[model samples]
Target: MRKKLLHIICLASMILLFSCSGDVTDELPALTRAQLSINLLNNGDVDQQEEINSIRFIVFGSTPGGVRLDVNEHILLSTPETATDIDAQLLKVTSSNDILVVVIANEPQSLTSKLDGIASHWTLQDMLYDISDILNSDGQIISTTGMPMIGVVRGISIAPDETQKVEMVIERAVARVDVFLEAIDGGAVTGYTAGSTSVTLHNLSHDSYFVMGNVGNGTRDNADSSKNYGKVKENVPEIDLLTDTWTAATSDTWAYSSATGAKNRRLLCSFYTAERIFKSDYSDRLAVSMAYVPKGPSDVTGITEKVIETITKVDDKGSPTAQPFTEIRRNNVYQITARVGKIGIQILTVTVEDWGDRQDIDLDMDL
Candidate 1:
């Protein structure tokens, strides 16, 4: 009986040992390191002029963990789309492990040019809605005139057991106003020349006049002959000359002294003789030319000139009509140049504001 009992105990011990060994083997496979990988592929042909129609990135693994993605963290290594072109596309990340960046080419038949149409598509509607709480409380127009304001998704997810990749794109929009100043020369007269000119602006709603300058004339000096003076010296009473309010005077000593007069003649003679008048029926039609100035990072190296339009009259309501001018929409980056011109002798003010969205991340992932 004792021998039989010991044999049974030995058999039971062996069975228990085999069961424990099997359990260990099963757990060993689970202990292996999980792998993470990401792959990027472009789905279109190389010759396609359509900007990147679609971009995809995939993550795969045997034991996948739900991945957290940050679209702002992903780097674009190579793209068919230029920085300016990226702003017109729609970006979508379909699945947790799969990312799809899509861009729809603007129809060639649109009223606006393809590039302009693309730029206009970068509307921050969603972003604006998200920040409505703060914006609604404020009364000021958030002047994002020339600013590059990009939108970003802080976090998103892919599959339950895969690495996550982010999705992103550029948003661009442009509001352009063109100005033209045509120099019209009136016949020359003694002591003065008549120059009738007009200003024209395109796509502009409202404008104000700050200063005016004579073409090629140095700074305004009433006593200097080299400078160009409107018709005050030649007219009998040149008080209402340049515009409706401007006039010339020979007897009014104050007016003659204040008007452009020779220094020696001003001291020797008590009054100024009327020469000729530079007359304009529309004071609001004054325009000036300025060297292209870039206030932002966009490359506007080749831009040469910009037209400035001014507002002439105000009705009972404050709405204004933009003076007539030509419009210029070139393919190159627009910049604000330092060299500026004027329509008269007054100082002009220029306002620079944000223009578009500029947000991107440089992501360096080993995978």
Candidate 2:
């Protein structure tokens, strides 16, 4: 009887210990990480939208009102889906802390250094540091020859256990200038030949992160190919400018990125002569210049005079003001029409649009 009682008492003690352990385990909260769903956008612009193979994201933790993200720890995630999980330690936050993130897609693999390995948190200086490696072996800006369809989303807020949905509108970091040669009355251009005219946009900046419109050097309007300028050769599409009403700027395909489609020319943003005058020359501006003669019967000689026209900004009062013109903002379109006898080319208009369907980008067709 004594041995049996002792065994029962020992079993009772074991049950109490196990029950206490279960209670302690229940009291502790489960480990939770911040969940994020990243949705890439084409800014609703059909032209800028491309297929994203994958994306790289960096999450920085910052205390409320603090300028620097915690440099000691960070979360780096490369994902192929629109939604994924990020390490909690890199994004763990208290009530007053916020999260800052920078994401890029379709960028060059060599550009991995641009984010500095995603190991530590970033300071304002680190965040603003420019990547000098944006040049090729010949030192030409990489963005000019071939650029990644850069889509960046910055300054996001996240809380512990919060599932955040983000829209990262991605667009071409460049503007496409569609050059048109036609008669003043919207007739087919008879004199100029296709594949002959090389339009040049001069004095543009090549900085990697020059995201804003106003923060750059002044641009110059020039037509001379001998000087510094960006040129698009063999760019004019095959169209009967005289007969076909080629009024819309993007009526032709805009190959602004390399995303496995016919519209993936992936050129960098060049200096664009603005068609809108709403903002008084935001920063240093540039001009558009091209000189070409109409195709003649091989023997035609005295057509020595080339159409040389320079556009100057006319103010609200309609006067040509020479304050360095506006830098061509990225993802904009400058549609140009050069008439036979007109002194300066007529700007049908400059349009900033989102590429949606055929109708969305060509909304200016009515004008």
Candidate 3:
């Protein structure tokens, strides 16, 4: 009995397939979304409100050799006049193998609001493409070329007052590919230290390009040589007769100086903003040194023009140094010494704008 029923169904299908007189066939796929016309009833009426009454769809004939053909169908509707429609309608579809038939219906009584708002209306073709995975559940394969291929269509229109109908057809398949970001070579860096001595910073990132240094000193004095009036030879001022001095004048030098081989004494530093130092392409090692000072204030003002008219002194020719001491090179470290004067010892201090961890440096000198 089961075999007999299967035979009967097969005969009926064959008859249906050959019954068509014209080119149109039941086997042919439906039209694409772009080809159909979708209209909303009473489109601009405030009171009635627009909606979809029913949908009308048509399927076209297939190409030779069972190849699918491309068809255009219409998909959505909008108010059209209010604003230039910049909104784009997108539909995503997937299939196990190939789609065969697709059916769509309104979500039971789900209707659009009367007020102005974004509304999406899907046509028969649009619905089919959106659910291609379900249609092709059986894994039935169909020739895509020349035969109807799946695709989506979009349109803009206003809401109608009464129930509306959307018509569409399915056709040629549309393919979309995905895109992303790739990295390139980092950037260039020219480093420099403020005063002298090459400073090395670990884990330096690409962003740390500028460097600076700060150096300073301090001093203290404790000596009394007065009222002796040259009475004793031991109390006589050894260096200068007019100035009072202690017997240990030659033995103890009052000059203030940085401790020998002190790393903090001659600072080597570099600077960079937080943003640049943390960049992805920064290097772990940094070698920076000070470069010559460019056109400074003195260069702009024509001061210290030329002592001798014929020959131009290279060092002091164009401009005198702006600051008391300008950093000549990074490799050269300054050994600052403070001499004791009549009053007392003097302290020296230095600060650089963009340097490493330390902001400023201070040194004590015995004057």
Best by lDDT: 2
Ranking by lDDT: 2, 1, 3
Q: Is candidate 2 or candidate 3 better by TM-score?
A: 2
Residue-level lDDT tens digits of model 3 in 117-234: 2122212212212212211222221112111221122221212121222222221111110110011112211111233212221221211111111111000011332111011011
The TM-score of predicted model 1 comes to 0.18
Q: Is candidate 2 or 3 superior in lDDT? A: 2
Count of backbone clashes, every candidate in sequence: 54, 17, 53
Q: Write the per-residue lDDT of candidate 2 for residues 53-127, one digit (tens) a residue.
A: 434544445554454433223223343221212221222322214444444443445555645454444322132
Off by over 4 Å in 3: 1-49, 52-59, 67-69, 72-367
Candidate 1 residue 89 C-alpha distance from true site, Å: 22
Q: Write the per-residue lDDT of candidate 1 for residues 43-98, one digit (tens) a residue.
A: 23233122322222222112244332312112232444422244321222223322
> Candidate 1: which stretches are off by over 4 Å?
1-159, 167-172, 175-333, 338-367
**RMSD to truth, every model:** 30.4, 19.5, 37.3
Evaluated at residue 68, the lDDT of candidate 1 is 28
Model 2 residue 286 lDDT score: 37
